[model samples]
Target: MTLEGWIVIGVIFLCLVFLVGTTISIDLVLFAGLAVVFILGIIPAEQALSGFSNEGMLTVAALYIVAAGLKETGAIHYIVKRVMGNARTVKKAQLRIMSPVMVMSAFLNNTPIVASFIPALERWSRISNIPVSKILIPLSYAAILGGTCTLIGTSTNLIINGLMIEEASIRSLGIFEPALVGIPCAIAGFIYLFIFGDKLLPVRGSSMDTFQDPREYTIEMIVAEGNTLSGKTIEDAGLRNLPGLFLIEIQRNERAIPAPGPYEKLREDDRLIFTGIVDSIIDLQQISGLKPATNQVFKLNAPRNERMMIEAVVSRSNPLTGRTIKEGNFRDRYDAVVLAVSRSGERIDQKIGDITLKSGDVLLLEAHPNFVQKYRNSSDFFLVSSIEDSSPVTYDKAWIAGLSLIAMVVLAATGILSMLQAAIVAGFLLLVTKSFQYSSALESVDWRVLIAIASALGLGSALQYTGAAEYLAVNLLEFAGDNPTMALASTYLATWLLTEMITNNAAAVLVFPIALSLSQSLGLNFIPFAMIMIVAASSSFSTPIGYQTNLMVYGPGGYRFTDFIKIGLPLNLIVATIAVSLVPYFWNF
Candidate 1:
């Protein structure tokens, strides 16, 4: 290896060290890696900022908006409610539910799907009487499979597509082009999950709770006169949906009924047994239908004998996602009280004491009973034990928020907008529409992932600019000696391994230039070869560390490291072979 080659290898090694060893932001490591190269007087100055313009990065950003929209409008919930709704067995449920999850992922971005579904899936476990450990990993895997089906599905596809367009004048990625093989790949993956996903799943039961479940909810709200609920049937006022509210009795006519008669008229002062999600209950009480007992979000009036704070994520299918804390009546319904919320690394402000909750929004609740129980079965919220409640925000436009995000995705997926343009538009819309909220979305951007991508892209650029890629190509050719199929398979395997250890985006950055270089060196159609690398890079299974969606399940699903290896290895190899074999035929290498 020449000096630049050795330096590149050393930098990669350091990057590996930083990635494997510490929690420092990955973006920082990436920037530092490239800085070392720049300081060494790498190829040129103009190229340093070139990565900012890479189509892959933009695709990632735009996809977030699309995902957010999909989540907001209840588009994904169809799959959640139907296939994933009340799963009984792990494998059966994963097969049924993960199938749609995969389909949705092919259409939407991964983050929102992941963030929205993790909590929902957790809840689904309790309802189905299945252990959460069994399905969470599969949930993530399904998302990956789904993403590989379409060009707009995952960032990896977008990156490769962008590179292809730039280098080969391919115009744009076809919507169902990847599906040519990705469909079969998905079908095979489902089969693989059915056979092995269960054995590899972590079996986390519902009893490992860090907080208590509350008993009663004290709420204050005004009874709307002439409303259908007033002076009608006693059972008509359904408080089951509200949060933090338990109707011991109605304090009306200077009398309280521990239990109101079924035929008795509402009389505008009827109190009902309403319990469950805390935020929904609180917000509901402030509205006209129910008056607050006092004023402060109807905070628990009586002092508790034992109070504990527990954090919980809203499971993907948790019925609690769309409703507010007030609507859920959490306290009265479930005997628990909510204190705060955290979503996408952003806190819920505006007195989350009275705010509605969202999926993936972490809630801090003060309750009783340290033992773990599956509240997810009855409600959409889960009790989290590790992280504390973050601060809150003021933005509140659920419908519009969902819509704005969908717009960006439609444009990009349809090829009306480039991934980069789509991403820039999505980010801008996120800020303008207040979907992410000013304070939270900025904080939620995952700067580490961003920087890591930029730096890795720089390294890839360097390899291409410095003739290092050519040298590597020459070496690969020498090794191949003459067998193109063997060379193609080897290249595919190399990308698969790299992706298993690094983010798919990073792997793409490192692999694409080399793929192009090798294809050119071989005097073969660069498109097919690039597609092979692309498919291989995107299909990194066998490890949770390879993908963010996979890692998100680790803590929640209580999964171990080996679980991924056992299940992912087979799926990974199978997809790799399929891609390598099919690409040459599809693009005619």
Candidate 2:
């Protein structure tokens, strides 16, 4: 090994040590390592910074906009609601997410599938009271397992297949050739996760879990006619298990059903009274079939989609302080409808129109985004602030977002466009069609995840450019001696280690020629070696940086570096054992 190779290895090792031992951010840790390699003259400036322009990295960025479009239009909610289907337990939720994801991943690119699911699953986790950490890892793993089943399932499979086609002597793989071993590995993975996931996955809670809002407000919503929630029971409608919110009663045309049972059916125009904190109220506003009972919300000047939720504290000097909301012409006077009011952490029992505004009472208002600017310094209130992500969902444009996603998938799958191109088109469609705002699209992207991915790619480039990856693979393969089976195992181990250390595609590319050389020298068929290489490269469990999907979920799942090692290392071993044992049987050595 050269001096540069040794330095690259040492830098990567130190990065891993810091990642496992400290709470520092993954992006910072990885970029720091890349910087070390670049500064040491091991890799040039262009090679070190190449990851920022990587197709895979930019594809992830574009996909974030696509996912954000789906989320902002409330299109993802329909998919999540159907897929999750009222799963009550952590195990059930995992099953619901993993089963279909695995199947879908078999035919589609797993990256976008995992991308679309991350936000939806986070929302689902909050609603279901299941920790996000428990399901995200399963989601990523399921996608990876499924990707190994078919030719188009993952890029790694196609990369190896492309290499095979390039060689005149080597036979190309069939569409389902990998499935022979892939299916058994997938089944093993499913069994392992189903049986032990609940215990093995961490139970880290989101920020919303720790903070309990002291101020509770009573709000009323009407079931819109012909909406999805109408004619469904309370439980079936998903209104029964809302966190920090409770259904106090359902007001029918003439009668009131207090503490409505879970099985009680909701009729159109049924006024459902809920007592909850501001967060849950915001959640309720997003539901497609539910609308604030106050007609004043519709009387606002700005379009519903353009408005936002604001909190205003009433001042003694305000003219409407002593008057009932309806009597004070609140909507006409302030151009904002009071959704709910909180008085000293107590719930107001009166209807929104009937509540008498008092000094120091906090008001949750729905109005144009400028409401804060207009009244923040005015004597009309004490403090005024707009809530983040509180805009009304653009439900009307949901189909546009949904169709754009479908188009992206079809275009990418059929080779009409590359994944990056398809994602770019989809994101563009979303912006032009107003399905998602450009500002929200920009905000929706997790810059940290993108930076981390690019940094990891840069590190992978350093390994390849420094010849560190090749040196390590050669040293490891030399131990196989004259045994073909031992050589195959060594190749798999080498590729797997490289994958954990760098990007899977880079690992496969670096190991491909070496494995081929070994096969030629041993006077054996290269088919088995190729098959093992495909599986080893794609089986990037054990570390978050090993796979794109794993990194996609790292921050969202609130996982540490050790979290991947603890659960994924075992899965890696299981899949590796299965792949090695079955590859030679399926393809002759």
Candidate 3:
């Protein structure tokens, strides 16, 4: 390898280190690495930036807008409620969730499919007495498997198809070409889930279970010394019907008022004790004059009202992981006050000040609304989400959004419009019909995912431009000399491992050139290799980091990292076997 190739390799290794070893955002990491390579003259500026203009990347972004329209119009809720009706048992529930998801993901993008299903399935899990953990991972894996079954199922598929058209001068893949291998893998994957999911997946409680917590906490909130509530009754102060929280007692002038009634008057320095889920207790922090009993909260520079609520999930790589909330000076560092903390559906006791933070600990915070937008891409949190409901559904436009989606699918499937054209048109129709505002649609797009895909494409270009992919391909072929079956298996396994380590689209882009080079060197058809890349890249099941959908469900399901390993690893092997066995027979070596 030349100096440029070695430099590229070093950059790729750093990306892996920063990604797996830290809580940093993948998009930032990729872009930084891509930028470094660009500065080094490994690839020209146009090549480095070409991925931003790639048809496949744009399609993914447009589809996100369309999915947002569907979600913001209540169309997604209507369809899920109708299809996932009354599945009482876990087995039956999995079947219901997986069946429709697979069918939808075959045509629609899987990211939004899994995102829309999460909240609905959580509610379903509550009513049906089924654990969400058992079903959420399977839901993600099912969508991934389904995405392999069609040309437009995932951006990765389209990306690979585009590369084939460009590099090999091959005809664009027919819409169903992948299904020859994808269908068998999907079937095998579904059966593996049905048989082993219950046994392998954890039985952790869903977020709904948090409401049933019987533990009471003596949460103290001091009515600030100069508060308006000092002269108002409990009802007058809007203390009634505080969901899941009860004002059981109050202390004023060092005297306790037990079972305070709605008509009870309040006074300054009154310490309030409420018992409820941490989610609700955190809501109390939003009240302007009602400050946490801990004096530490008042030390923040921002007033309570100026501060908004954000939920930050701590990752292992967070620098504050081992420190207590007070010890860490969390508020001073992030300009956010920790209002409440939860771990695996259980609330940390009222002395949250003393509790140590750990990976996966969710902190309900009081900060500026932009706090979420600011730290959302930071490495300190595994996931940063706003507590506010900014995008409520416009129910009046539900039917319009639904009809638009159906039309987009029909038009694209019938070849009246290309997939990209259909997606763009559907997104425009969504904006025109008022399903969502232009700002809302733009916000709905997960820009990080797009940036990551685009940056990864640039890296892939570097690999090809440097002759690195061809060099790697020649060596990969040495192991499978004179054996097409071995070459196919090796390529599939390589793609699967790459997918496990990085985003699927990036994996497909980085590996396509090598797969093509290997097949050409061996005097074999490239169709089988291309089909294998589709199946292998899409079948990312061993780790949460392997796919976007899996990470989306991670916190809600209360799942540990190992939960994915136990369940997804087996399913990964099963799907890989099915793909390797079938791709050759269908595509012919």
Candidate 4:
């Protein structure tokens, strides 16, 4: 190996440990490393930064906006209602609910698709007295399967496509490219989840919690003197500022203080309760110069009468974002109270006092049932009302969004409009039609996913431009050495391993460049390699950490680590075998 090869290997190793060993945000870490590579001349600056403008990155961003539009308009929830309507039995509900969900995921962003169905699945499980564990895992798995069905089904597909076109100018990847292998794999996966989901998966709350939520760690802590504004009320103490402190209880000496006053003095022995985000407690302790009482970055709602949690999606065109909830009169103008907010699986625990409203932040509103209905079908927000009703469509306006989206899709597919432009235009039109609010759509776009995609794409570009990808491929081929099938298997297995440790999109971005090189060297077609990369990325079936959809259901499903192992391990292996076998056939290699 050359000196550069050793350096590259070291970088990859450190990246691995940093990602898996610590909670340092993976997106920032990878991108920072990519920047370092450019500074070191490991990658040309153009190649290193070109990924920022990659078509796949834009597609991912645009798709989020479009999905946000659907979510904002109550369209996704509308689909869920239609799917689960009159479904009585757990078995029937799973088939009716999960089957369609998997199918929908094939066409949409898999994460949103899974998230969109969560409430409906939970409701159905509760109504049928079925264990949510019986359904949620399958719900997640189906979405993963659906993701494999088309090029746009998952960001991994688009991302890998972007990498290939950039790396080698491969045109074989465009236009319904993935359906050849993806459709069959999705079909097989759907059947597999249907047959084994219940038996293999545990029921929700089958363990410690009443829900299938993960094992939450509970810790104790006390406040320290000399902290900034120690004499300030708890409200001013910035207890809310402390990350990972999900307040559970407050202790005074030996007695527990349930709800201490914000103005209460920080007695030497006062303890605060907290829940998630525990990792950041130490940082809070250091920054605030507060002694780490057993409780960590310790950190709810107004009175039951005044505080309320309403789940509402920001309209795609909402202008309320970048402004505090107070500015919009969220409580007054909306006739509802914001009790809690959930965004892309993470909860915003801050007091709704003055937090800015973002689109796609599922505002859990606390309000009267009467007012909740009024919020439903409103263009400004999506009211997640349990009471179902057929919306009186402004037929003209509805078609405007529908036709615009279709035209965008058609234009892109036919090569009239670049996919990036198509999505951008679609997002804008949704706003003009008031199908969703523009400001809301922009605010609601999952910025985290966007960052992750951009960063990973940059990393992929670095690896390729620096010859890291080709070097990795040559090494693999030296071992597999002329065995095309083994070469395929090696890349698939390697991608799967990385996914088990990092984001699936990141995994795809890392592996696609190598897989592309492998295909070219072996004189094999690129489609099979592309197929393997796509399927492998989606095959994060083994652990909750492997996929966000899995993690979202982790706590809610109350599943143990072993729970995923028992159910997902087998599914992972099965899909792996089927994907590898089908890819070669589809690509005729």
lDDT of every predicted structure (CA atoms): 0.59, 0.89, 0.75, 0.61
Clashes of each: 61, 0, 1, 40
lDDT of 1 by residue, 1-589 (tens): 5787667767866876775566554567668888888888875766665666666554544444444433333333333555553344566777876777888889886655675565445444443456778777777888888888888788688878887888667567687888887887888888888887777666665422321444223333445555545765444444322223334455576566664555656666444433334434433432224443323323544323223345667776666567777677767655556654556544332333466667677665655434125464335655445322122211234355455557655766687876567656766765665444333344334444455555666766676566565455445545654466776776776667666544577666666677666667777766666667667776757755567666556556765556667777878878877777787777776
Candidate 4, residue 423: lDDT: 78
Candidate 1 lDDT for residue 224? 53
RMSD of 2: 1.6
TM-score of each: 0.59, 0.97, 0.60, 0.51
Encode model 3's per-residue lDDT on 1-589: one tens digit a residue.
Answer: 7889778878987886776567676678889999999998888999899878876667767877887777667677667657765555678778888888888889886765675667556644554457899889889989998999999898788889999899889889999888888888888888888877788888897545656654333356889777667988887665655656778789887678988999898888888877665545644553546777767655767543334566788998888899988888887888877766667755454466787998988776766677888888899998998854323232567888888888887777676887679888988998886667676677767687678777876776776677665456456546776689999888887777767655577678877877787788889999888998898888778766567677667666877656777788888788878888888888888
Candidate 4: which stretches are off by over 4 Å? 1-5, 22-25, 32-41, 86-94, 101-184, 191-404, 482-572, 579-589
TM-score of predicted model 3?
0.60
Better of 2 and 3 by lDDT: 2
Q: Which prediction has the highest lDDT against the true structure?
A: 2
**Residue-wise lDDT of candidate 2 within 1-589, one digit each (tens)?**
7898889889989999999999999999999998988887888899999999999999999999999888888889779889999899988988999999999999999999999989878877777778999999999999999999998898888888899879625778899998998899999999999988999888885636744766788889999988888889999998999888899999997789999999999999999999888877877887779988998998889777778899999999999988999999999999999999888867676789999999999999999877888999999899999988788785899899899999999999999999999999999999998776677889889999999999888988888887888889999999999998899999999999999888889888888999889989998889898889888998888999989999999999999999999999999999989988999898887
Query: Candidate 4: worst 10 consecutive residues by lDDT?
Result: 294-303
- TM-score of structure candidate 4: 0.51
Question: Who is ahead in TM-score, 2 or 4?
Answer: 2
The list of candidate 2 runs beyond 4 A from truth reads 206-210
